[model samples]
Target: VEISQILLHQCQQEGDETADVGPGGDYRARNKLLEHLITGDETWLHLSTAETKPESVTWKRRSSPVTKKFKVQKSATK
Candidate 1:
């Protein structure tokens, strides 16, 4: 299951700027894209170190509204 297509899809969905700066960084997005490419499903990829191979890459699934946490709530007590 090659995820290159999926990675590309996600990149398109996220737009170049957001995808580039998202969460961890460019490396994070690359790893995430790669995971989706390999698994054919959404997944996360963690880099063990700062070093990375030029060819290696990944991407993350477009976060959902719930996942993004658009709202804030105060604690309630009686």
Candidate 2:
């Protein structure tokens, strides 16, 4: 629906009598203006992604058997 709308709009803007669905079986026109729009949109998307910071992960500590053994040995020596 969007592709058809775009094609129809562009065709109307260019004063065309009928709209063509482009060469590729899809409504994605090879029109320079539409191509610019697509690339510009992609550029904005990339910029937005690049400007954002990634989230940092939190770390947790786990209990270990080695620490328990060391504690037992230390208590015995004391």
Candidate 3:
């Protein structure tokens, strides 16, 4: 399976910035985040580390991506 899509990387760099600048900087960031929240701003970007090829996500209910193979086996009595 292949997944090709641009994902919006929604993350606040506030924590890291705050760590470097201290509590005062964090308060401003907090305020900024709050303002965005109130105004519904889209502060998203694509991560440089984003993978173009996504790994297949198999569920716990069905461990493998080969679901049809298992389905046929389970319904073999038919």
> Clashes in each model (backbone N, CA, C under 3 Å)?
9, 0, 0
Give the runs in model 2 whose Cα sits over 4 Å from its true position: 17-78
- Cα deviation in Å at residue 71, candidate 1? 66
Model 1 misplaced regions, further than 4 Å: 18-78
1-76: candidate 1 lDDT, tens digit per residue:
4666766777677653423555656433334444444434555554333336563444556673333523444444
Q: Best by lDDT, which number?
A: 1
Candidate 2: global Cα-lDDT? 0.47
The weakest ten consecutive residues by lDDT in model 3 span: 1-10
* Deviation (Å) of 58 in candidate 2: 47
- True lDDT of residue 31, candidate 1: 41
| TM-score to native of every candidate shown | 0.21, 0.21, 0.15
Model 2 TM-score is: 0.21
Model 2 per-residue lDDT at 68: 25
